[model samples]
Target: MKKVLILSTALTSVAMAASAEEISVMSWGGAYATSQIEAYHKPFTAQTGVSVINVDADNPAAPIKAQVEAGNVTIDVVDLEYADAVRMCDEGLLEPIDPAILPAGADGTPAADDFLPGAVAECFVATIVFSTLYAFDESKFPENPPTTIADFFDTAKYPGKRGMRKGAKVNLEMALMADGVPAGEVYALLETPEGVDRAFAKLDTIKNDMIWWEAGAQPPQLLADGEVVMTTGYNGRFFAAAVAEGKPFKQVFDGQVYEYDGYAIPKGAPNMERAKEFIVFASQTQQLADQAKWIAYGPARKSSGPLVGLYQDGKTEMGPFMPTAAANLTNALPSSYEFWVDRDAELNERFNAWLAQ
Candidate 1:
């Protein structure tokens, strides 16, 4: 009896040790986090017995920087926007991720070649190509529905409160686009003093009626709760609400600003090896494609494109909803990471000053 008791105690301790292994992934919450949970976390835990604990943030970049700078890094993995990833990597706040660790495409192409251009960075591995676009509650605009970027700015014609992100990046670009600046000319114009003034001048038109949102999740909720008739939000969030939840929201791809969002290990991560494994598993071709079923964001892997099928409901095709869809690209702008890397600080200062007025 004594021998049996000793063996039982030893077995339980081993089981507890195995189950205690977990990695923390910080990401933008709401529907986007759900997608990662379904497509990445669950499968990863099942395969490796290493659990994933999700940490939500309005934007993970700010917290990550703070964590790294303070030398108390709690998060093992972080989802970062492209420009933030580049900036943090340059500042040595993130661990260097070797592309060689990533698996090849389903078609057996090398990861370096299989990934979309700029998808694999020195310290980041992009998972999706998401777009920031404006969405409207269909019931709010039953007649003469908005169809252009300019329509989003026409308060007199639309007659409702507008929802926008409380940041300068997309707002400035969208303002220029609405003011009739071509997609190709937006960045060039933004570099000039007169152009920066012009963009703000356009925003001044709707400043009073603007309902600013800082999180990706808030825009859809603002529209659903009738706080705003039209709002800008991530394409995936709107798609999740409109399709999965059966909301009457409609997205306008016109003047959409699309960029890559992906995973990076924070410097001095406690679970560095496991974090790398999670990133490799999450960014696999099939895994990337599977994420599309849960959200409208395009997979970063080119091979994943053909494998993308229907939504989780198994009816609505996801191709046409992707930001990379041919029709949607007709009037879209690929976000410029280089431009943001150079001007984020100064422009944000100007934006904050304008907000105070």
Candidate 2:
């Protein structure tokens, strides 16, 4: 149960007064975002007298569209991918935020600079940074396991079936990286004809072992069920899985792609004032640090707390299975979101054609 006194919990009366009227927060279900809501959002409501209406959706887009189309600005706040937020805002589906109303202390409001530089945007601030890594069950590979995407393809060496996300960005980047292009060069490679072709050619090698994961939840489920020894998805899902089930699976962040999830207010939100309050309440730096413990997603505010890296109590979570460790985070390659955002539709067309071929 949350402490009933909002003013006492956050050291502010602003949030306390706002909580009386409920604001709805839309997010993916399961332990993924619930932990943050419970630890952060719930407390925010309790102290401020605000009632937060939580909305859960497997695919959040349809409902957001429906809500907006229905002329119901019921979804006062949206926690969604940056791309969707940008698109929605471009479509006049989002509202600009006034940061002044966001909770602030003597030091001023926790600004975008407080977050990962990648997560800040015109109308949306990235709430977290999530990465996808190659994970393997340690016991399945007593000695040699896939360390990099190249190894993931080295069926001769790490010969179990491999898993990759059905999604395009990370998969494309990994294919290019595995084809011997340097990590830094992966994006530029796709910019050229040869690089794009090279990625598909490389992908052909393990296409048979590949299982296309639709939801972000599937890859981790694959690992848990022993369907495939290695797979990729949000590093948090796999990490949280291991933490939740005490599974033997591991994640390797080496050359993983990370993306910034943003906190956006829909355009013409009915409760615009309250939405701003929610964003401020959601991003308290201390709460971010606490959230990292429950969700593998790291704080956009890097200053939060000691995030689990490759080690827990001095043990390394590295190798092929774990991506959240510091060592893996250090070496991991990330996707070019700007490139993907710009060319994804074209790339998707070409990729689909290639898949058919």
Candidate 3:
């Protein structure tokens, strides 16, 4: 950080933000957005004297998906979503991570085995354990809390309108759980007629109370305004609101479905040599923890949480975010991009039609 530099999108460097070569990070764009580019990559440059630039993480403008498809990958580091990570790996758009290159610093972090199970199960490791929970305005539901996905659907017990994400991949697993399936059996059931049918049947029970959300901000607003007493929301989004902004809202991760969004080098990154260095540096446990502090999404390395002890300045971590919290793994969902990719069209069609009912 001694010889660092700083700069805004349209401005030049200010201080402690310098780096030899700038790394372009792919992520969302907005004012309150906690993009990896802005939070992790940008501050990393300021702190470690490394530099990173911001770019669109999704397709269309300088798209990573299209470029990877065209046999030329320009993005050095990518933030991969559930299926996106798997899709890139299968298509040879990601390079394998070699931890040996990324040595732990003075903190004795970057220790292996810290990442969540779903991430280690995949080639690309976890950067953040993002979850979808039934969030509510505590003021309205002062006497009650929604714990499980089943409670999410039960308007009788909960007794209020609900907001639902339109996307089916995560919701399907959730729907299955609400229908009385356990976490271990979610995927197994999806593989059978009974599982898929049971989930849809449960969803049909609350179709009337459901208000479809089109974007990430939709559910939060739907909750903040009391439009719906409870709704499915991303942990980071609610973390920003409830914890960071001190909003009177609470999120129940008891039956939450957690998803990982983290770094994966393109199969043939133009700057493979430099890309590898960035990956190793970014994956350092504390660095992941530092990034997590800004978002409240748990880091890949378990050491990050206990070692860093750096809570995001304002956010309150949901009980489940703690490594030893009382989490409801029984109803948790691990979205399989592979399965969704294959059955997306058919499954989504079936699920979306059911949502309309």
Off by over 4 Å in 1: 1-20
Candidates in order have lDDT scores of 0.96, 0.70, 0.66
Clash count, predicted structure 3: 12
Give the TM-scores of the predictions, in the order they appear. Answer: 0.95, 0.82, 0.78
User: What is the C-alpha local distance difference test score of candidate 2?
Assistant: 0.70
Model 3 lDDT, residue 214, Cα? 58
- Across residues 266-290, which tens digit of lDDT does each residue of candidate 1 receive? 9999789999999999999999999
Q: Which candidate model has the greater lDDT, 2 or 3?
A: 2
lDDT of 3 by residue, 261-338 (tens): 677776666666666676766777766766655665666666666654444554344434532344545446666656
Give the higher-TM-score candidate: 2 or 3. 2
lDDT of 1 at 329: 96
Instruction: For candidate 2, write residues 1-357 as lDDT tens digits.
Output: 367575477766566555438888887766666666766787887877788887787656557877787787678888777666666666677776654444332244366445656566667766677776678887788886667767777777877777776556678888777777788888888889888888888888988877777566777788777788788777877776776668887777666877777578876676787788778777766666656656667676655634433323235333233333466665567656578667767877887786677
* RMSD, every candidate, angstroms: 3.5, 7.5, 7.1
Ranking by lDDT: 1, 2, 3
